[model samples]
Target: MVDPRRAFALRDAFAQQVTRRLKVPAVEQRAYADRLQAALDGQTLGGLSGEYVVLVDRNANVQALFIYFRATPSDTWQMIGASPVSTGRPGEYDHFITPLGVFEHTPANMDFRSEGTQNDNHIRGYGQRDMRIFDFGWAQGQRGWGKGGISEMRLQMHATDPDWLEPVLGIRHSKGCVRIPASLNTFLDHYGILDAEYAALAESGKSLWVLKSNRQMTPWAGRYIVVVDSQRESRPAWAPAPGGKALAKVPAGASSAD
Candidate 1:
């Protein structure tokens, strides 16, 4: 299984962290979680996190990504923080597909070369547009654009690259955006990546790992994945999987038993 902890963490933030302002109610948030879990319960690619807050969706090639994070004591992810990422699309001009999972990114990295002056202070972009997410819709599908000719990726979780396992669309897949966990997205946009700190957990060798879903949100551009949260025949059993093997590049980590 590919450990997301092994994934690259490029420093690109205008500030240090994202801002959170709970827009959804606790009841609504819990309801959302219930719906998400219900759909994922035994579904092919289900994932959970030590942290409660999580994001799910189809990546590319029918694969899925599970970005996880911990919510504040208030039972809100905003109280904790968020991250920035690229998701997959369903199909033709349909750029609203990404996987789901619990991840911890902080989403503080900001690229001023691209963001501009306005974002300089806010650690945002030049336009200082709040991508606090699933919040800003690009009209319908592809109308999500940015200011100063800066086009909006129109994604819930905005990232630099496309989260995929195999190839689906190169320069043509997404119309103008991707999607992410609405709350997480919002938080990341508020704060940018300033100086950061990370520590690997003692129980787990890797601190940052992606709990990939067996379900294909889209086609993975041609990478490998593993199941993080599921109840299936996967070696881990707890995290079900199929074609997951060790890669020459990744280190040997513990896996599930068949």
Candidate 2:
């Protein structure tokens, strides 16, 4: 059901809008694609032929997210764009390490928008106002604090505070949710990159207030967010760590969703 022409156009738009890019080699792209297919199979979810899927490496050494598009279930996934992100950082109380698996973004969990309000520490927990929070409902995650056991944590992909935390996005800083750049947030929202269900509803004549009226939605809107940990011992040169003293000053428990 995906229009090939529109899918290509969306990829082009991704390149223009997403500023931070990760140059993943063709081989690595294939590997991630393999992983994505495996996760989907494990979860018993159908392969979304001609749809776009988001992949994230939650490894401590490499915190990056990728957008991939496939023309068919059997086709190779082409990398559309990549960006730096912050995954769960466990070491403090109430922090959970981001779970690894294929998570589906659906209306069952109900996505929400950030008010962009600052907490007492003067940090915008969910980035600026109107930022879309891609909710995946409660997921079992490894506890980063306490005795380090497993617990249920709400898994979400959203933008972090632009001024204070967005700069250090490459490193782990969130409680359990995935923190992304405001630009990437806008890119995903405006394109309905992961809004497959929302688009479907709209097509059925259901008006979703969350979807922007001026949006240029792709025909191949996807619903899966595949998270994997490469378990790399060191950071690769292509995925450089964030520099500056600001990395050290990232406040503990900065995420508001915890």
Q: Against the hidden reference, what TM-scores do the models get?
A: 0.27, 0.93
- Writing each residue's lDDT as its tens digit, candidate 2 over 42-152 gives 877556667789999999999999888877776777788888899998778888899999888998898889998988878888889999989999999999988998999
Q: Which 10 residues in a row give candidate 1 its minimum summed lDDT? A: 249-258
Tell me how far the alpha carbon of residue 198 in candidate 2 is from the true structure, in angstroms, after superposition: 1.1
Candidate 2 weakest ten by summed lDDT: 249-258
Off by over 4 Å in 1: 1-20, 43-47, 56-156, 159-258
* lDDT (CA) per prediction: 0.27, 0.84
Estimate candidate 2's alpha-carbon lDDT, on a 0 to 1 scale: 0.84
Query: In lDDT terms, which candidate is top?
Result: 2
Error of 1 at 75 (Å): 12
| Tens-digit per-residue lDDT, 119-201, candidate 1 | 21222221123222222222223222232222234333332211121112111133333423233343333322111221222
